[model samples]
Target: MATVSLLDVGKTFPGLDTPALAGISGSIESGIITGIAGPDGAGKTTLMRLMAGLLRPDSGGLTVLGREPLTAPELRLRVGYMPQKFGLYEDLSVLENLTLHADLRNVTGKERTQTFERLLAFTDLHRFTKRLAGRLSGGMKQKLGLACALLGTPELLLLDEPGVGVDPISRRELWKMVHELADQGIAVVWSTSYLDEAEACDSVFLLSQGSLLFSGKPKDLTSRLRGRCLHLGGVEGRRRQALATLLCQPEVSDGVIQGRNLRIVLKDGAARPDPSALDISGPAEWKEVAPRFEDAFIDLLGGGPGGESALAASMQPRAEIRESLIKAEKLTKSFGDFTATDHVSFEIRQGEIFGLLGPNGAGKSTTFKMMCGLLAPTSGRAEVMGIDLRRSPARARERLGYMAQKFSLYGKLTVRQNLEFFSGVYGLSRTRQRQAVDSMIESFHLKQFLGVTTDDLSLGYKQRLALACAAMHEPDILFLDEPTSGVDPLTRREFWNHINGVVEKGVTVMVTTHFMDEAEYCDRIGLIYQGKLIALAPPDDLKADVASAALPDPTMEDAFIELIHRQEAS
Candidate 1:
């Protein structure tokens, strides 16, 4: 019998026009990893909440472990759930957190000790047992959350976005540990926005607008796009324009930028894209290839069927490349004896895309903060557009823009109000501020949501508003700190499209991200490890440097991990 069975299950919240989940039906079995895949606001989180018996369905019947999920008192003890933000007591040590969880689950004696040892070893958290939870890295906290959830050997595990804010290496490790649990006869259901991660699942459930889109094996979905997907290689320079053109084509189902190459899927009976049709100054190549999970996903969403035409804004003309616009010479920052950044130096040219990457707590963000003048460097010098930040921080800030990782907008304000507030913050005149806010509303498609409170908007709309606020001043340099975290993949593509449009107009961007795949979008990447710059190169070069015959097809994540390992060995 299936571990979970849903029959026409539905849920709706009061005052909401659309149901959060509707007509959802599926069966999840034991001893396998089942992936729940969807875009933002697709009811992925709602389904998770329902499965854990935290919410009652408004319609249909649901059974978990052969008991009615809504009223099963024993289910709580046998199921482990980690919400999007897994709560870890910041003041408690790693060991203390685990102990508290064990106490809650009533685990005692040898069983508790044995579970603790096994979990610490599996999660690589033994050395950090005494360390406070607040000090542990983003990845470590996720692992610790899993360790706490497994205190009583729960039969079914539900993880909702546990990997959302973590680094690639730690994400891989977390997935590896979860697979082992499934191997031991436990059922695992994890939700994610990344299709690449979903493809590896034993079974996948694709959700859209709270309805079931596709379910069953991941391979079955990709099979539908056989002979339709093509990979365009030898692509260089600004990828935004090329990607934008392809996505707008009637024959193209979907397209994305991937490490100097463009991966696309065509509609049935659609002709191949001719290189001559692309607006380019040089040669571009193309070839038919096997479709990835993302290709199939795009197809399922009425891929070639098209979306809001407003999103396909025309690309601005390429900007002239000037001298070094950003310079960091032997930049270093230290907290007491701990060095967060050591002797990091690099230069960013005008209109260039620079990516900063590393594991959690690897000082990548610290370097970004220093360069943005958010935090002062303990030593060394940095400059933006020839202005010395150390001597003139405020003047340096005026020439730049920033989008923080978290939602920085005020929750109490409306959409237009947020834009107006940001414009004022940038010292714009009342007339200019009104004009800027109106322009932002049109550009970001905030027409329909002008009156909605920022907190009440969907995640995708919230992201668009935040971006609009960032670009309201039209600064030359833009700093995005994990700008796309928690957003759906399609939304991420749209966000990049806007970014590409700006870059074409001579705006330089410096970004830090945990998504290894996003590094492909950068013109150059700098990888930091243990407060040191270990690797600096294009994504393709970094991949080639670590790739061997055994792993010729290395991903950005693989290359990143290899670089960190090399640094440690040295």
Candidate 2:
């Protein structure tokens, strides 16, 4: 039986010219997980808000729990929803926040205590009940939000991008828990930009511009592109150039770098030739490969210019320049008796992409903060562009461009106003400020959005604006902390496109990401667990080394989970 039903539903917001949902007709089955997949502005959020009764449809009919969610007071009690930015009181402890949620749900007496115990244990937050929600890392905060949403065992759950910034381990746990909830006869409707997560669902709905483009099982989409995909391997150190070359080919429908190989899908009816004589990389080794969810989506979206635009301004290649730009030695941080970063050390070179990865609350951010000079280490050394961070914090900051996960921007200001303000702060003169703003508008495609209020912009737009402000002065090194958290796959590639362009001009990049696939793009990655750097290696090397014979071709996510398990066991 269906728990929620929609019949030719349509929704439009006031003052908006387009309908957020157009003829979104589908019934959500009880005891099953239904995933909503789409790009940033594809109406996924609007659809979730409608399912949760947070917004009313302007046309047709929609119902939740067999009742009209808008006018029915009791329907809301049975519906649990967590937005992309789930609201959690920063000052409240984890246990306190859970308790408040239970209270609101009217789960009293024995039930409240029993629910708390079960949820704490299930979420692995039982030992951290006293930690302030604000102090929790991005992944920990996501777990707390899930705990609150699961209160009272609601009949239906709606989660909007709940795993955006969560580590792979925690993300897998969430999927496991959600599947278990489905087994208990609770319907789950989840909206996410992560195409990989969509494959884990019983069914998927793909939306674009308010219209449903495809609906059914995830395999239904990927299976269509089976024989069309190929994995091409170039000479070591020339993979990116090969990818750039493939993106310009008419026969290549979509392409991306995976480990040491470039995976591309061919356009239908294109001539298939031997890979040995390709112009970009002659004698290229190639193999027919199965397509993943990401490949299918890119093909559907008409992939072009894989990372950067064909017309993007050129950044002179820095191929010959290889110098250690940032260095850390025995980095350690402690709060009372608890150590956050335990004797961590690493070095990053100019024009290289370095990634820091770990589980939620695993001290990745703590290490990043120390490197960026936002936090002082207990006993460690950090240098940025040859300037000692401890001795010359101000001078070190001038050479670095840092963007936090929760990027800070003026909500009250327009898009251009915020850019102008940051330009001045970065010490750009009037001529320089105007030049920077104009260049940013063109680079970020923000000309039309210049007058739009920053707070009212979409997640994708906000990301572009934040990045533009960070690069106003074009610092030598860029530090990005979960920069692509809530962005869709296409938008993420676009963001990286700009970053890739600048890196060619001798700009160093240090980043932290929860998306395992993104790690494939990095030159090297550091894996930290329980406040200790346990492993450091290239992405493909790490995966191959950690993968067991049983799972010979392990994914980056699989490798991550196994590494953490090994670390904890030791």
Candidate 3:
């Protein structure tokens, strides 16, 4: 049965020329996960709000559970909606928040008690009921929010990017719980920027710039690219260079580094070109690989930018430095009796991309904060460019650049204003600031958005502006904390391409991310768990350590989960 239906729905916000959602029509049925996916500002949230009856369409019709959601007050009672930022009071205990939501939803008496017990058990959050919501891990908080939303026993559930920032193990657990809910005949509508999640759904609606591009099974879209996907082998150490060259080719539509090889998609019906013809050095082999949902999505979006990073090309190369640019020597941080970072030690050399990966509350962020001089360590030292962070944090920071997980820029400021402000903060002279801002506007393609406020820019453009601000100072070292958290795959590729270009110019990078595939791009990875560094190795070596007879070729995620499980077992 169709739980929600849209008939040529259209929505337009005041003072905006373009409609947020235009002529949208789709059916969300019961007992299955219906995925709504698109890039940033693709009307996903708008459509979801319309279904939840939070906003009424300006044109066309929308029905939820066989009733006009805008006209039916009771429809809200039978529908549960979890927005991207779920409202769970940080100061309240998990149990208290649940009780509050139950009261608001009018769940009363014995029924409330029964619902609380069932939800706590279902989300595996019973053990932490007394813990404050702010103290819970990213995954735990998500579960708490879900529990609160499910309090009214709604027939339909809406989740917007529920897996964002969640580690793979926790994401897997959440997926299991959601599937179990669907098994109980509840309709699930999951909106996400992760294409892999969309591929897992029973059906998907792909939107772009306020239009419905595709609505069907993910495999049905993936099958359209059969025989077009190929894995270019023998790239090995030169994979990034080869990928850069391959992307410039007219025949290649999309390409990315996969472990030690380059996975690429040729334009539809385009002849396969030889590696030598594309100017890739040495012997290379091409093997046909299965098409992924991302490939098809990018294809539908008119393919990715088919050239080297323009942002990288505009920057000047850095002077050669043979020593470690960043070093954390026995770093330890503790809040009272709880240790957040326990004796973590690592060194990042010049031009190397070092990754620090861990589950939530696993000490990665603590170690990062200590290294960046944002937090004082209980013991040991953090040295950047041979200068101690504790003794001279300002000097150390002057030589480094940091892009936060949330893109910490003034949202109300315009693009030009943000660039000018960051330039001035970096201590550029008046003339240099003007030069830098002009160069950034041109390189990042922000000229059109110069007058637009940061709050109104698309996520992709916001990311571009953030990178521009971080790199405009031409710092020797860069720190990225979950830099690609909630963006789509295409934007992620673009961001990495720029990072690769900068690394080639002798910029050292220290990054932390939950995306295991992105981990493949790192030179070496340090796995932190329970406030201790558990594993440190190159990406291929890490995967090889966990490879087994049943799983001859383990992925980065597989290695990560296995290593963490092994540590816990020990």
Q: Which segments of model 3 are wrong by more than 4 Å?
A: none
Per-residue lDDT of model 1, residues 84-162, tens digit only: 8758799999999999989988889998899899989988999999999998888999999999888788998998988
Better model by TM-score: candidate 1 vs candidate 2? 1
State the lDDT of candidate 2 residue by residue for 1-570, as single tens digits. 578888888988789898888998888888989999888888998889888888889888898888988988786679888888758898999999998888888988998999999989888898889999998876778888988988888899998888787788878888888888899999998888898988888988888889998888989999988888988775455566557666667788877777777777888766554554445555577688988887888788786446454213633344444669999999999999999999999999887889999988899999999999989999989889888888998888877888888869999999989999988877787787798888888888899998999999998999988988887677888899999987888888787777766776668899999989888888899999888999899999999988777999999998889999988888
The stretch of ten residues in a row with the least summed lDDT in candidate 2 is: 309-318
TM-scores across all candidates? 0.96, 0.94, 0.96
RMSD of each: 2.1, 2.3, 1.7
Show model 2 residue runs off by greater than 4 Å. Answer: 272-279, 304-320
List per-prediction Cα lDDT, in the order shown: 0.86, 0.84, 0.89
Q: Highest lDDT: give the candidate number.
A: 3
Model 3, total clashes: 0
Best by TM-score: 3
> What TM-score does candidate 2 reach?
0.94
